[model samples]
Target: MTLQNDLQSALGFLNQGKFKQALKQSKGGMKRHKSHPDFPNIAGISLSGLGKHRDAIPYFKKALALAPGFHDARKNLAQTLLFLQQGEPAMKLLERVLKDQPGDQAALYLQAQAHLVMNAPEAAIVTATAALARDPRQPRMLRLRATAWNTLGDEKAALADYQAAVKVNPNDADALQNASLLLARLMRQDEATETARKAVAVAPQNVEARRRLASQLISNGDSAAARGQCLALMELDPKDTQVLEMLARISSRDQNAELLPVAQKALKAAAPRSLDRANVSFALARIADQAGDKEAFAAHNDEANACMAAQTPYDYEGSERQFSRIMAAFPDVITPAETAPEGPRPIYVVGMPRSGTTLTETVIGLHPDVFPLGERGVPAFLLHPCLDKDQDFTPEAARDFTADDISRLPEMPKGTRAYVDKMPDNYRLLGHLGTAYPDAQFVHLCRDPRDVALSIWRGYFSGSSLTYAYDLKAMAHRFNLYGRLMQHWRQVMPGRIYDLRYETFVADIEGESRKLADFCGLTWVEDMAHPERHEGQVLTLSNTQVRQTAHTRSIGKWEKYADVLAPFIDGLNPEIWPEIKG
Candidate 1:
């Protein structure tokens, strides 16, 4: 064949996804036409297609060296760098390509991807928007833009972009799955379920597709359908720990004794030190508890805790030091009138994990004038950047918050009197929050330390922020720190915080609900007692418990596990012991 024909044949194979055939043709062409960069670039593309990203890099570099002005070769090199996780170099090269050829859609798309990886969603949005402007119908660019919107917490924008992506590429399983998950989070379960079904239909053999379908079904409270998906997933890969974990959760939810054997098998087969082993052990413990095998339950529970503690050791002293710094920094608290930031004042529902944060947020959110923002880190993000952690936050330093810091907060929706931030751990941020939004209403949830400790210990937490929760000593110490912090807040700003005891709230929902509404400057309404009536996803471990009517079944649950919680009781503060124990 002529050189031109050889190139055309190689290009056809590459475009058809016949990587091996393309590689063979390209290699033969490279030997015959040693000076051409296209053959080398094609060879790199084939190697990359075969998952040899590192091996592909040298060929890409060779192509770029031979033809410095070849935009295709440079773009190919950038993509290969991105595939190999060399993000900085990839981004620099992509920026160079875009600088030279201002409307290169491929370079813009890859630059957007690089920004997403770097956690710069704003930058990603800019690049992705530019790409879409150049070629408005590109499904990948639409999906990339959707991701940037999602990361920016603009779900409506993300949903619109995802819808556009699916319209452009109906068979895009990832777009379908993302749209479904977002819909689920937005509490549009029916639409989410349909979208997830479409994803599974499009990619029946894809484990992630099945997993997402199962997740959507779980959110929709369709355990039977979710279990079927889990079983199908198990058939595809029985040893998949995530599938096993999902099966265990579904079986536990249904209280199905028949599935106990699956949990046992998973526990026995999991590696001794793996997080999966710990999770499976916890599942077995719950099953054992249900079976009335107290000893077996305790053993499994302890093993799981030990595994978790090993994996994520608590920094108790460091936490104490940080708390002390916060306390000393803001010793003299300013009154609500001193700081001046306008808009609907924030109501922070702060407490320990498994405390009444979700319940409190739900009840308060029921009020007509209140909007629930639901567990945002915005306050912390703003406040932390101003704090010089090494230096104490003196009254002078506390006054350092400028209007620009406050302006970063978005305006509340029209007619909303206030918005609630229900981050449970915001208990630790009360002092800093007071400095930023002195007029901010604080609703602090105080639960029985024993119940709180037990609940936290038994639950599955995903982040390092709660590393102390898995061990009784760490939990008790953390609780002690919490108590000290609360006491400091009360001392510094007397009568400023509305203390909502969980037991009192649970026992007299209507009365506490009315009083809380009064505290938040709202008139009493009967609807305040039915938090479950409110819309929006609850994204905490308390999600299941919060959806039901207010009940006292969990009031003294730690009593049943008293023997297991002896250490927690002993380690708790002597002054607070009576109230917690009773």
Candidate 2:
């Protein structure tokens, strides 16, 4: 065959994951045409096989330079960019490829990939949707579409796409594996388990598929099946962090200690990524607590304290003022939002992150009728109309919801007698909620702005949404806005708002718990004392803390990190501290 034909054949071999065959074919092809345009592309693929990411970039670029229309080389370059941690630029590069070749299935797929890495689900969905429109049969595109939908808070849409992706490519291990994960998120445990099985059925070599299946089985409450899946996965890839995390979970379940180190080592080897740190840290701490090592216990405790950083309180007067405007403009949906809800009168968990809202919610949830569903962000998703990108909340907007808006609550939350809506950032949407459920209870949860700032700086939230979490001054400005708007809510909705202090919740748990229960229309119960009893929902980054139930451990936990937080919350008006403590 000619040099070009041989090079194309080599690439086809590479695409099939036949590294040995691809390397041989590529070597032969390059020998035939040492200076050919495809030589660099072939060499890049071979280098990538050796885990030489940095070295592969130039070769991919060379291929593109020689053959400017080489779409495959561009895709490889984008992949290399992602590995280099230059994700935003990589996305732009992928976008350029798509612009040059509209309807290019591969380019579109990579673009969706870059969006996911950047944590922009809304953007992910838009790009994924366009990609899907052009190539519905591409299983990877379908998977991307599903992930994008999930990020957009469209659970049903995500499931549909996942299903389509797997159905179109049953042996596509990645598709099956990812589809199963989305199924678990949708709470379809049994189906997810089955889907995970199918994933491994095709690609038993794909370690991640096995891990995903194992996790789904465990979530389904089928511990045995999950463990079996874990075993199969370990046989395939013993160094997988997620699989190790699962093994640790199983070890704990069976009262076995051997798997603990195995899990820890795997995670550490993975370089301690961001998303899984909260869960892993909590589990690791639990492991240490079992070993009777006080220092380990202290470190774990510190981790819990550290996790609160994502809970940055508000900043900027404009944000809060805008939120207040939104709340005031909020039109009431439920005609009798005031009725049926009695007791602690529903302690509405308000305040920005690091504002002690979690502590407040934990204390209150301990009360008999109070359910501390950690960070159930459903309220925030449904109350989007009230969220203006940058516009001040206008009363005209609040009254604009139609019948569809009012019907949302009964549809979303299914069954519950006056449950607490703990959407922290909901302060901005509270007024809209007021109109939606006019009679629904409210609690303007707060904490000393300084303490809130300190709490945030010390804490490490795995799923942070803003850049503010990493910047103190800017974060403080954000906190000021949230607090100030909260202040506005108290003023306009006088006698309607009550503040719960994070510090006071620990200092006076019983009293606060009692008051909080009453606020939320719940009859008191002794079980509320052990907030740890209510577990299993991975609602937010505080999964570990919520799992242990609410306690005073996190309260005043930032005393060590105090010096760091002082500058941020100190900028906020002091008027709110008195309100939170009382």
TM-score per candidate, chains pooled: 0.80, 0.62
Model 1, 1-582: lDDT tens per residue?
A: 778998999999999999999999999989998888999899999999998888888888888788988888788888878776777888888878988998878888899988887789999998888778778899889999998887766676788899899998999999999998777655466688899899999989888889988876665555678889998998998777677666666666345477677778888888886788888888777777777888887888888888888899999778877787777766685544375566777899998878889889989988888877667654554456333355544455555543433443434458987888888888777776776676788999988888888788777677677898889988888888888888889887777799999999998999999999988888988889886676555556665677788999988888888989888788888665556645
> Quick one: best lDDT, which candidate?
1
For model 2, what is the alpha-carbon lDDT of residue 459?
A: 43
lDDT of 2 by residue, 1-582 (tens): 897689788989788877667767876876787667687787788778767788888888887887888888888889887777667988877878878888877777777778778887777778878877766787777777777776666666777787787678778787777777666554455666788889888987888888777666554445677778877777786655455555555555334366666656644643332434544554565566567664664565455334433344324564556555565553342232333322222335777775656545655555544444445445565546446453433444444342333322222233334445566777775565565455556777555565565545434444545445655676766765666666666665655666766667656656766776676666667655555565333334344455454556655555655555555545444554444334
Q: Scored by Cα lDDT, where does model 2 land? A: 0.62
Residue pairs with clashing backbones, model 1: 329-393
TM-score, prediction 2: 0.62
Which segments of candidate 1 are over 4 A away from where they belong? 1-52, 65-73, 118-120, 149-172, 179-237, 252-255, 302-325, 337-345, 368-373, 387-416, 435-439, 530-536, 559-582
By TM-score, the best candidate is 1
> In model 1, what is the error at residue 526, expressed in angstroms?
3.3
